[model samples]
Target: MAIVLRYVDSLDFVKERFIGIVHVKDTSSLTLRNAINEVLTSNKLSFSQIRGQGYDGASNMRGEFNGLKALILQENDTAFYVHCFAHQLQLVVVAVVKKYDGVSDFFEQISLVVNVVCASCKRKDLLREQARERVQKGLCSGDLETGRGLNQVTTLVRAGETRWGSHFNTLISLMKLFVDVLVVLDFVKEEGGSLANRQQASGILAYFKSYEFVFYLHTMYDILHLTGTLSKQLQRKDLDILEAASMVRGTMEALQSFRNIGFAIILPKICNLQNIGIDLVKQAPQLLEYMAALSPCDSFAQFDKSKLLKLGKLYKYDFDDSDMIDLEGQLGIFYHSCIKDERFTSLKGISDLSRLMVSTGKHRDRKCRKMFSKLKLLKTDLRNKIGDEFLNDALLCNVETEALTKVEDEKVMERFEKMYAQRGQI
Candidate 1:
């Protein structure tokens, strides 16, 4: 178990510290609670000082009853639980992709393609050579642009179950090196040492050449590419929940827009690969619904209470009961009360100042310029009130250091010398 502490320093900058990791026998709530308490005790801290707790959406961690979060809250109710946003986004992608049969099958086939082509070093070398030849041909014909780091030899990347961005990279590599992949598969089908190997290659090659597979491949590439961008943005160390929420809503809106008009946008590219069109009208709605529903829980953050109530009323035609009415009423009351509180109305978390600084630097709006001037004055006042040493310490509080012995330094130098000698030989 890992323990992290977040705090605002004298400079009003948000900082995170890694306390330590605790080894536990099991992941039961009791065990986790005890481990956390032990770490707190050893560090001379108390549970009352904690203001927030974050964890993945696990039953043992975030359950309302008999969970680690619940136990912590029992001790100090102020330590509100914030579920891991990145993990939630990852789960959303995984669930949505697997919920659709066509998209799911596309992923499975891509995985198989990677595994088959990279099973042997001979096949890998052949792929590299073929990719090199294609790049050279394209360069000579002036069909492809050549520059630094452009048109390099391509390799198949295996898709990972946990990392959604890897799927995007795999799809892109496959599309870029489509011909080379087909050539390698064809070679394996004909010259394989065993009948079973040849048959497997033949099956994969046929599937790779299918129109249905090609269509889904391009379609999923477009979809995953968008979500993959969101996943990367959410992983940034400086991002705050508000910015992350805003990004999530923007991505959902983009996806909805794509669902309505993406066929026309993607069809031209698909036709370039194969001069055929498959009817997707009957099959697209379900996939679009699944994709739109991926982050339903986070979608609510996009709207104000009034808009939400209006949306609930507008969608009442689909529901034949009063659940929508009850939901809207409850949401109206909750948000109405929360909006009146000063804490909810004026609270700007850690990322606000940094975001303002960026806006002031990049934008030339009157409000932004005035806000930047006020921010500069505030910084000067704070620096004068709190000495420079305190601000310096706050900046350097998270820096970790280690002492290197003389013998270790010599070992590093010797290793570098050996590497240099080997490089000369090469």
Candidate 2:
């Protein structure tokens, strides 16, 4: 499969207090090297500009002596490549859960079951039809159990620690409705194979009782709160989404004053997690150093795929395929809302403007220019309402421009000239 590099702009909860996209691609080593060099050379950003580098536990990105991190660090020794804490935590979760054959089997069975449920329009229609009938007949009808696709599974799994508990209901509720699923499974068996992986199914059901499972369940809430929306309450971090940025600044200043005393208090709390030998937890002092070394080039390379898969594995404990399915449905709803909802006009315009500003070189076509013009006009009105910091963030939305090759650079120039001439003709 051809994998395109996806760039996501997000906040670094532990360091830098700035939002930037971590770039990752799905190309070969040669392609990756060329792509990284192209981004660095074309953008005129030095290795010094990088404040942090984060990658999954992958040979390509994180190889100790010769991988992407090493190559970048050679260019700028100060570049602090931190293993993505989220990715590492995901790995730990997977390693912990896989101790029981049942958990692994559960994932495999759920995957198959989900496939059976959503196999086709015919199958989906049958499920809905049966569900409706069950409801009407006074039979207990519950959530439609299905397998989690990659995206759906990831969302629920990686959903911050606090949200996982809410999802527990979402999972067991599906299990309660499993009998209804067996009804659908009968249709699947008639069409093809049996719905349950009977051999592994019982073991998975048994594994749920393991102490590891219980401990994982206990930590899910704390983990969710830390990773998800609850971490926003860490007023000292000064993340943007927190209400009243100025007020947070004051709180941060107060924290700075108590740094020695605070560390005396907080070090013990941090050490608890570090005792397990998680590097990020141990390297708390390097937070600023890591931030100082992050680079724009890191934003365009292929992200660690295995790490994402690992996260999916960890997430499987609390979620199944239905959660993923619902996420997709929700995404579809959000997408349609962006396209059709009148209330989203201002938000949509801002999103478009942000995209236009980030577009670079030949990629910058008529649409971008038009959007920029409109954005420039809009800014005059929005400036007073939105603070400079917020406005700057909107402008910097595409902080890393399109990764262009030397050949692509020439093409971009040629295309720009043609478009420029065409505009002149008009």
Candidate 3:
């Protein structure tokens, strides 16, 4: 199990730190809980510190009664559960596509094309070479502009079940390389090759040139474009729940507006959707109250003192009687000060207000993020197939690279020697 610690520091910045990974022999709620306890105990943290839970929509992880989410809530009720926004959007994409058989078949065809074109290094190289030549010719003929980031090639990216955003990337790259893909498929169809390969390529070439495929292609492009923005925003570290909620609302409205147009326009658009994050709020009244009160939107326009005070009482362990006495006055002053301050005025939305608040020295001190970008190296295709223990070791070293640099080389060598010496004997 991979553990991450997200907490607000004394400075009030929300920080997410990748805690070390824990190995589990099984994934029962109890077993998972114990693994969690072990990680926290080793780190000298406790259950009472948990403020929220986020996981993908997995039955074992987010199950209502016996899942790990419920088990944790049993220990800390204040630690509310939240389904991952990106995962929810991915589910939306999966479901919305299935609503129409045409859309479903479109994606299936896309997957098949990706598989056939990317089947071998020779084919991949052929596609790249063809795309490169086409772009070069266009650039020379003034049909394409050249710049630092413009007119660049889009390498075809195959979509996968594990990477939800892969569909978006695949759609875009394939759109850019549509001509190149057709050329590659045609070559495979007519080339001196096995009979089965020839037949499959010939069929794919025919599909690529069809009117139905083109219709579904543009339709999904528009739909995924809107949802893709939401997915990227949801994964941002600096983004808060309030900002995300607003973004989700905006995206849903845009999608609905797109749907409301006649079928002629809707031919290249999508319909059917569901409101997200509503259930989590419905499950916990305190959560609803907290989000309502904590919104620093409209220059503290939504600040509610009574609900905030109620939230304080709900999490009594974190707020003492003395703190409680002072919180109300502080909340009042904070709200008014933000309203009067020019720095807070003309802000775009909640995220801007959140950054301004954290910048002020008056807020609590919270240790937060700057290391997550380094985490991407561990998940790239070439680096993904790694064991948990080694993954954690790499994470620890990467997260604290400066600290690792300060350690003596001899000490590192001694540990490595000890680890490998036994292997050598075996």
Candidate 4:
């Protein structure tokens, strides 16, 4: 059973607000949907009463074809589904670290040793003692989560919405304690621990020593924050649609800065088990910025979906167009206009199957088949399914001019110039 929390607005209450945790069963099996139907049938709360819905980053809960959000939207167009920002940010960092071989190896090594040390009854005790010693030595004071040092490897990778900067501190602190952990492992080995234990410890130590691990720890912050920005927007309160649209616009603007970094190195490598060049690091930041910016383009759907899929591949998050039940037409218009510019069309091979085949398949001649097959597997379109109204919006575009008489315009311009001159900041 899964519990889904929904924010309900109360029109009759004094405070005009209510939040409820609807206990749902095996959401994967449609238990929650059945339950919701039963409740709505019995109570006065119709589909019209629902204002917002939130779920963890579970595929069954957010998937487009059959997830909880899909089922809800099918019933009521007003029930807006907001992806949990905290979860999105978590997935972002994991995607980036998974790219570099060195970083992946380092984390795998850390998890291997951390699991070994904390798995056994005796070893778990040793970890507690280590925690106590660290506390006594003033390195830490609270009951330390030794299990998470291994178990939360993925969680630690991403930043938080409210506490985005904590990810940086988590990495730094982990590195500082890494040596002390090895010392404890050595103590266990000399005390006649199993040979398997010694092997895991040595392997972990060697992995961390590599340059790749160190580089990953250093660069993780950029990717984590970049993702956190998305999470914050996705989870933003639904106070107004205009505000949400503006936030989406800001996110898109920020992501544009990341487009220069080649997709092959940063996004594709993270999404799949592909080898990436370390030199790609030089351009990843700007490229990541560009990737983030693309999120808000309503006509964004018209752009290459294969590219977006590759970008989203690393994480377990989904942004269903249908979920934007209210903004469908607007989104279509945004994406259609976005791709018409000479700049978007000029970007080379962005839609070329031959180039896509290079990364995922062996035969370039059969690239179209491979590309289509891959697209089908993900249940997505290669090109965004944008409508024609986006083109109409583009054609109808005109700067809305506020007409003023020449004398009025001069007076307004003169006052603006006087203010600007006083500032002397330009």
Top lDDT: which candidate number? 3
Residue lDDT tens for model 4, 43-128: 65666566556676778888787988888877766566756444544554465566656656655655565565556677655655
What TM-score should be assigned to candidate 2?
0.40
lDDT by residue for model 3 over 1-426, one digit each (tens)?
667787765555456667776889997888999999888888898888887787777788999999999999988987878777777777766765676677778888899889888888888999999999999999899999888998775678988875557888899899899889888898888882688888888888889778777776776676677777878887886776667777776876776665565235645443332221121111223465466666655666677889888878767667788878888888877777877888877775544556666787545521112344656777678877887778888888887665578999888777877775555632
If both were scored by lDDT, which would come out higher, candidate 1 or candidate 4?
1
As a whole number from 0 to 100, the lDDT of residue 255 in candidate 3 is 64
Whole-model Cα lDDT per candidate?
0.65, 0.41, 0.73, 0.47
TM-scores of all candidate predictions against the true structure: 0.64, 0.40, 0.75, 0.43
Model 1 root-mean-square deviation: 15.6
- Model 1 per-residue lDDT tens digits across residues 298-409: 3223335454444344333333357565665665555444345443444344244334334434212111102223324434754767544453333333322112232376
Angstrom error of the Cα, residue 365, model 1: value is 30
Clashes of 4: 20
Error of 1 at 210 (Å): 2.2
The TM-score between candidate 1 and the true structure equals: 0.64
lDDT of 2 by residue, 383-426 (tens): 75865556544544423232222246567667777765565522
Candidate with the greatest TM-score versus the true structure: 3
TM-score order of candidates, best first? 3, 1, 4, 2
lDDT of the structure predicted as candidate 4: 0.47
